[model samples]
Target chain A: MEQSTESDICTDPVIRDQWYPLRALAELPEGATHHTRLLGVPVSCGVTRGRPWARTESAPGDGGTGALPVIDTYGYLWTSLGEPPPGVFEIPEYTEPDRRSMNAGSFIVATSAPRAVENFLDMGHFPYVHTGYLGIEPHTEVNPYDVEIIDGEIWATRCEFFQPMAAATATGGQMSKYTYRVPSPFAVMLYKSSPVDPERRDVIALLLQPMGHEQVVAHNFLCLLDDVNSDAEIKRFQQIIFAQDKPILENQIPRRLPLDPRAETPIRADHTSIVYRRHLRELGVNYGVVPA
Target chain B: MIRLYDWELSVNCYKQRLLMALLEVPYEIVPVDFFPGWEHKSPEFGRINPLGHIPVLDDDGFIVRDANAILVYLATRYDPTRTWYPVADPELLALTAQWLMFSEGTTNTASAARLHDGLGYDFDVEACRAGAHRLFRVLDEHLWFGEREGRHWVCPSPHPTIADLAIFPDVALSEEGGISRVDYPAVRRWMDRVRHLPGFVGMPGISPPLATSPPSVG
Candidate 1:
């Protein structure tokens, strides 16, 4: 128990004081309460009167700091362990009625939340990890991408890669354009070209719910303009791609994402990951990160 | 056409699929909803194989149940060279059978732990993991020594046999059950050897190493 407690996600202000996804809205039944760990503290969450809420058990003499605020938005129940930002970061495309917003799937990954986020930011692994779907070798090189913090959010633009079967709607290989956003340490989103609706970018967001410093429940949410494929097929395609990444992510040398510049070698293609790690450092995020 | 009652994630089922793929034996998949659906345990499936397990192969109505049994049947019937089953050489045949038997230990321990975590089965996970680690240690030692003897596979054969495929899934996907292979370098190298084999196909949680840059199959 002591070891488990010690290994739970660090509880520093920057890492803990932000909203994290608890579960998808579809899975939550109204009026049920249960406790689950968040940033190392057990918080009870339930839906009441169609409003999801979360609260923690405060010991005596701790005052009234037990009520952790909860909000339901974009098909998930979100809660904060401490002070969250003004609102859950903006996702303008989700409001479009024709755009289908859905849950791709959720997986329990035995690595730090940051590792999962970094994997989303990486396209070099696509040729290898995602294989034929997102990329294939001989065409494996990732074109130069721009990474910078815009208004305090990490953004990577101008990223592109060639993929065989880019999506459920993909009929053949295409040079897929990619844009990435890291709104927080554990959340990353990708805007890739919609194979069916080439004019519109498909949104795939991976949010990490940190169960511990070295473990997380990764929730994949998709907002896409694709009407050619059924929801089930879309989910299946995303799940297959993610399943391939699972083995590689789990087999990484260290379970925690190393923030130290010298810890892991970086190449030109890892520009986004390198920038994201720097952003994490700027935020003073030590949870789920290797000590320098 | 041969039909296999298969689940993509099951190591036992995957071995049959892997062997068939390696043998280049084109077959149809009778997808069994083994997880949330539990179709394999149904009365209808019970008629196919009373054991209520998957990887039950029906080759033109000749039914073969169990993973190893199907492997034995396929290698004997399909391989013209007969290098896989080695029926002609008694010594190699005994060694192949020995490793195939050892593969079951991996299934019961490592794969059982995966079932508990991934599919929510009732299992003593700690015990399962401990048993798996014990088996992996012995496996690592064996592979390490075999490399020294210039034997690339579990069986001391010039070519890989059914035993390699049988054990590959359980050992490769051990991390799905939180069993890390970091300590077993020799075992890791052996899995890579299996992955680089022509016609190698990966199920969920298994993929060829990125450096090998092989295969379009995800």
Candidate 2:
């Protein structure tokens, strides 16, 4: 006999509060065809087998988008593969062109604006959260020089030579000077400041959207001087950067309570954060601060 | 061979199924029984997932678990060149991820709570109500701010992405779960764009799957 417990799958300490077994709610005897309504949506209890397939629906032309709505079908069997379930569709392996790769002097990383800005400014987090990844010197500074809002999107300027950043700039080194535009507060854009002579320049762009508060969808884009360029190296580089950001960013709790201001200590290192926080406060945006 | 562990009426499961249909991927379906505690805890079933959850996908030899992860894998590995996975800026990707998280983590929770409580399930009605209120309020605020900026809730792009696909089902079905979506006109408009997608799928009326008679294990 096989038994499934809520504890086995739902590892999240918080989610466990509502982790009742589907079987408990279904009211059917053990070893029967099981089904339960989770959050009001109907689903078979559990078990999976056979190849994947969709439930049959009428052809779209038969009526319209309103008719013949789509649905999924599940059947359970067995398998020897130790592979995990498919979370998203897969992309076929392909050989990318070199000129389009990182050799083209462009790279892209996709992450949320909050996480991105925090990473750029919070030197203390890098050493701990992104260990063996980025280092910061004791005297590192993240000075904000300018802030602008064009058509509802925000662009800010900061001078940073925290660590490897200095080395990257010394060699014809441009700091991470880029324009960040949030078309909607939910999405953010970061691209190199250099222009392509009244048209374009080497650019790396990332788009982040929320799947849910805890989960997010991110994609990487490598924009180049020429639209026809191709490169596998840049793609690999972009993916590596994404992999690096994933662990740290995902670990951040979006809704954590704010620290106590009265008992708090402020220092010179927090000058940049204070300025940014005050600006947002002036705009009446609640950056997770509690009232005194 | 493609094997899918899915429930017939789930919007999240439909998300994956819809993609397969749009991409014309061939797959075999496996039905799991959730009612009588049969499939979920069977020794045979436990082998696939000890958690005993549905919406599991089994590829030729590889298995992908989470619904969003499966969607990302499909768009990337199967339809990389398709407009579905745009070759835009990294911001677009971040923007999409943000919405996906909102749908699955926030909207889904509220929507589900409304359904369970409204439909007479053993739900914590007060808790559900409070949760829904908080979640919808954030969305309402975002929309209010968006309107001030001459935009709706769409991300930073001129077009839509998987972000929209990720959120549409829950937002549309929210009304069925006892939510008064009329208050959020912007969300309604945002849903209109989602409905117009090339291969959009809508949630169906709530009803249990077929009731099969018992079979003897002896």
Task: Say which candidate scores most in lDDT.
Answer: 1
Which 10-residue window of candidate 1 chain B scores lowest in summed lDDT? B209-218
TM-score of 1: 0.76
Using Cα atoms, each model's DockQ against the true complex is 0.19, 0.02
Write one digit per residue (lDDT tens) for candidate 1, span A1-292: 1124644736679877778987777656688775555666666688899877888654233334467788888898888877887679889999999998877766666778899999888888888777778888889888898988999889999999999998888999999999999988789999999888788899999998887887677888999877777555566677778777876777777888899999999999998888888888878888988866
Output the worst ten-in-a-row residue range by lDDT, candidate 1 chain A: A1-10
Per-residue error for A58 in candidate 2, Å, reads 50
**Cα lDDT for residue B151, model 1?**
82
Index of the highest-DockQ prediction: 1
Q: In candidate 1, what are the lDDT values of residues B1-218, reduced to their tens digit? A: 99988766678988998888889999997767564345678899999999889879999999999999999999999999999899999999998999899999999999988876654456898999999999999999999998889888898897999988888899998878878899998898888888888888877677545554652221
Q: Candidate 1, which segments miss by more than 4 Å at Cα?
A: A1-3, A7-9, A25-36, A43-68, A85-87, A95-101, A225-233, A251-255, A258-268, A290-292, B1-10, B27-104, B115-123, B137-163, B176-193, B203-218
Question: What is the two-chain DockQ of model 2?
Answer: 0.02
True contacts kept of 1: 0.19
Tell me the tens digit of each residue's lDDT in model 2 across A1-292.
0112222222222221221122221232334444322211222432225222111122222221121111121111111111223221111111223213121111111223334433444444543333322334343444444556665445554533333321111223233344444433322444443322223233443433222222223434344433331232233333434444544553455431123334235565455344444443444432223322
On the 0 to 100 scale, the lDDT of residue B197 in model 2 is 46
Report how closely model 1 matches the true complex, as a DockQ value. Answer: 0.19
TM-score of every model versus the real structure: 0.76, 0.38
